[model samples]
Target: MTVTWAGANARRLARQHLHPDAAATASPFAAPGDAVAAMLGAHAQVLSAAELSVGLRGDGLTRTDVRTALWTDRTLVKTFGPRGTVHLLPAADLPLWTGALSAVPTGPNPFPGNARMTPDQVEEVVAAVGDALTGAELTIDELSDEVVARTGPWAGDLVMPGFQAMWPRWRQVLHLAGHRGALAYAPNRGRKATYTNPGCTPLPGTGALPALIGRYLYAYGPATPAHFARWLAAPKRWAAEQFAAQAASGAIEEVAFGEAGPAWVVAGDTDVPDAPLRGVRLLPYFDAFAIASAPRERLFPGAAWERALGGGQAGNFPVLLVDGVVAGVWHQRRSGRRIAVTVEPLKPLSGARLRDLEEQVERVAAIMEGTAELTVGPVTVGPHA
Candidate 1:
């Protein structure tokens, strides 16, 4: 059956718990960890953004609640997972993420020329990281020292030039350690972040890829293999093979998504609700809903794309979602006891939407634990530019 974009949007919004009325219902999530588990995980490259991502989906959850889940309760783990980015995932789900990520063939080393380490050397570094981080949390510098000590001085050699500085070749293996379930971020010590082994064992079997793909579709379908591949940062051929296998097994079924063409949803998740998406939301940077949706042009239509996404990049700034579509971009800055929130709409909003925007601003203020001042105007994009 062909699902129109409108139907898809409504389903997506409801499934994500972003529809205003849906969000108002008794929250499906009982805690911050529940929200993370439901969404697969929240992008946590920026801790505040990740916290807000959970807060938006959870009822009456605060930033402290998310921190407690990550540090105090240890119910959630922060690690490099999909797309090799840091994410806050349910601790119990680490096995699935680790096994799935490890199944992907490692891509080329980012270091240039002779600086690149052989595959063996890369494995050596990964092993060293596991050893260094085991049983104790260590800052990056401290961990690097241990890596060098374990793998010789060459492990400390700088490579991979960046806009500001060069990164050590050994640092590349950090994500590998995470993918192997040998590394995760520990609670911050003073102001410095540390890493430690999470002590999670992979589930006994070889169904990791299929399990991970199933979870993805449950949260972010109906989508194509290409979308899954892009989200996982895995090769398209590998994704297609896995997708085809699942389709053959009746684990997933194909459906047409209007102009988006053929897509797959979990075999039993084809029912799209006819809910109207209302109200405005101030979704923070790397918000899962905005980042995971496919057929980018449809999710982010017209000037909404350029205005909110800048030069086609996702997650650079917070977004303003009006009726389940990317209607504008927004930024929030906190100082002392106040937060200044500025919004730039691609088009004029209705009076009711403007009120809904104010309510969202209030919600943002509450999340920050400060009073908010709303300013409606164009936003200056780029990270703190």
Candidate 2:
């Protein structure tokens, strides 16, 4: 239907506010410095590779889409891997996107679990990895070995050191690297690329922070600072303040989140309840539209989500979106070259919803080159007995 700029702002924060230039899509790596700058803002960082990847798709484009359409080198922008991350933005966003997205987090850490090391040991590991990756790029395998050799006793050997405390700190170190411009990605990460150490630059401080937050809300809002905080994993107080500052500007608008005060948003960026909505689709696991916004249960039931996604690692599982609403959950897997996709429903889908999910799945298949099988089925439903 006719989704108003306002309603669009409210419901589709992940999609509405993010705007990577058409030029980057035209030629993603051809001196995409400007496009990147526009996309990422001043700090030039992204919070998580997966998040960036999903945001790109929500933009109606995928990482590879930017490549095929942009017809530029993939080595530079989206595929630039590691921090164990990927960013779907152009070369320019390296600055601001990092500034906005990189500095915080939500949920538990996604880093591989390794709890043997103390903070200093973790620092040593980071140092070892950074040193190996300083001039030349190295794979996680290579980096892991170096870390083991340097620190000995191998606390996180070959493992990503996924403990909760370490995860946040590691995220910061990577963010610091991105700010330094030392954060770029390696050649490939298990076939996908890794984030590089594009070098370092000083952060923009508090002033630039809110602007960065506003940009995020512009692209993804009508939510809480808690949501923003969770998304960035920044301290709660700092995140709330950032949202407030941005809200003061007419560019932001706050709406109610149940009994709470209105959540901050880019005012006209998402659903305002007064407007209609656009078409719907099945979103990927870790899709920005699904996880990026908070009161996450806003779209789905909490208990069901925990069950569907295996607790803290809610990153797994597919998401269904009908108009602006989250419809349900689904998933895809690959056996050899065969891709099997399945939809496990939380609620029964209407005929129209089923048709919509099919279309979205095809879109996903197209992204993966349609080389594998895809399927859909009910999650768990039993008698009232």
**Number of the top-ranking candidate, with lDDT as the measure:** 1
- TM-scores for every candidate against the unseen true structure: 0.95, 0.64
Q: What overall lDDT, based on C-alpha atoms, would model 2 receive against the true structure?
A: 0.49
lDDT of each: 0.83, 0.49
Q: Put down candidate 2 lDDT per residue, 81-154, tens digits, no spaces.
A: 21234444444444554554444433344454453345586466556555666776666446545556766755
Give the TM-score (vs. native) of candidate 2. 0.64
Please state the error at residue 169 of candidate 1 in Å. Answer: 2.2
Q: What is the lDDT of residue 335 in candidate 2?
A: 59
Clashes of 1: 0
Q: Please give, for residues 57-102, the per-residue lDDT of candidate 1 as tens digits.
A: 7777778889989999999999997889999999988898888888
